[model samples]
Target: MKLARATFTPGVLGGPGFFGGMFELPGGYLKPVLVSSCDGVGTKLKIASVMGKHDTVGMDIVNHSVDDILTCGAAPLFFLDYIAMGKLDSALVADIVKGLSTACQEVGCALIGGETAEMPGLYHGKDYDLAGFIVGIVEKDRIVNGLTIKPGDAVLGLPSSGLHTNGYSLARRVLGETPEALSKVYPGFDRSIGEVLLAPHVSYFKTLQPVMSDVKGLAHITGGGFTDNIPRSLPEGVSVRINTGTWDVPPVFELIQSLGQVAPEEMFRVFNMGIGMTVFVDPSHVSTMLAAMPQARVIGEVTAEAGRKVEIV
Candidate 1:
């Protein structure tokens, strides 16, 4: 297993120091429970592929996998990645590994190993894709599967780091890849198009882990945005009512909305907009969770309805 390497990004927040440090399995634990999740970076890779950058893709995979299991109240133990490409460039591969190593260290998980398949004729030359699998553990009683999400439960929304690995296909259509276009800067952007598109995926393991027990349901706002993913963690006769003006939508999303002529409903359906993860928590403990995670805001409340839905007020 030749783990992919990443470009050495030197800083306290770069590699091992990026996260709080490695975490050990809980000692004196009864019935060690294992949880796992597998996800790819989705067509967001198209932007990276067009930009000829590969380092951050590895971090994207790591963060996304970590969030998946964190929703189930699992602490990430280790991560494995799969990178397939038409050809292998040592520099590109190194960049991927470096990002993975940095992200793994940050989240206190081990980047034990991974695979790099150099399959010619499979992927187009100069094109690659990433998928990751993560394993984590928790006590049997600590899993958060939404069974406890009641009608009065509060929904807290965590701000995202831009797009975070979803809705790129449409994003690309709205914002294409010409040298001039990629080099130009938006009004509020201090970075160029490539820079924004390559921004690392946000990891929530440390942010959400401590409060998972109090969380009745955890929703990772991904592909279907809040509209689709939130319902998966919801129980029957319950839905979420989202307050639309609770947080400022990131400008990048606004760019997509304006350029794509995307309806508010479709925008929520495709992108995180700004909020990445929504947590359904007890009304009483909502303040505690919010205090622990200052970035999280009360976006909505759970409700009993005919079907699962997200009403964006």
Candidate 2:
């Protein structure tokens, strides 16, 4: 509690005296709608625990939650975290907080508050769980709900750093669960499996902030991969046709597939394959959007399809 109060200070966050701290928003929004999302690091935490790495997991939760609200064109205001463990280790807790503060500062979000619980029976020795909740604001008129998305709109993809806090359950099974196995370098990857697996989730806020107005829809590729997530942003009667040959599939994904003998179709469904976030925009704005995000690729296009939401070819 002291840490939260000191970190979130007065003026930036609501001062002490209420059950929850207050967040004051500066005027400018015509029809401000508060967007909130909560997400956890999932089984990826198991990898962290095994590796004794807790810092980046904080970023994993924050970035995951941020992207969730970012889909609606919202700017994050504040973030709260929940840490539950069997025992409280000051050093471990501090490391986690350091990561949380770093990510929150990077994205201009306040680490307003958090909860840390020490439950012996609930969690095993030295084990912990991490979750984050974020609140952001977007003008009602400016929300990117995909309702305006039409056929022929271009779908641009933003590349991911690595797994980005998803697919660890299967990754571990494919790569092997032993610590030595995780530390071993794979055929194509320069870094160990642990390093690639623990890469911090990338926040698209900075890249997308300038082009939010031009974007008709946004999808953050996480657990569901392209198949499930892209559909979330599609309107009725429209579907996205992705050209599988448009972008290079990251080597790590290829390594996982070959090692696990995972089928091609399941690879796209379970993993990002390469792209992390997808942006749907007017065909004419493709160059401008690409200029704003040079790393993004013109991966696909939206088409008139009665029932399908996404098609990878």
Candidate 1 C-alpha error for residue 207, in Å? 0.9
Output the worst ten-in-a-row residue range by lDDT, candidate 2.
1-10
Mark the regions of model 1 whose C-alpha exceeds 4 Å error after superposition.
1-27
22-54 per-residue lDDT for model 1 (tens digits): 335557669789998889988878777667787
Instruction: Please provide, for model 2 over 1-313, each residue's C-alpha lDDT reduced to its tens digit, 9 standing for 90 to 100.
Output: 2233236733475566532467888699988999999888999888887788889998889888988999999999998888888877878888888889889998899888887777889999878888889999999988889889999999999999889988888999998767898799877778888888889889899999998989999989999889899988888888889999899888889989998999987888888888889999999999999998999999999999967568888
Q: By TM-score, how accurate is candidate 1? A: 0.90
Q: Number of clashing residue pairs in every model?
A: 11, 0
Give me the candidate number with maximum lDDT.
Answer: 2
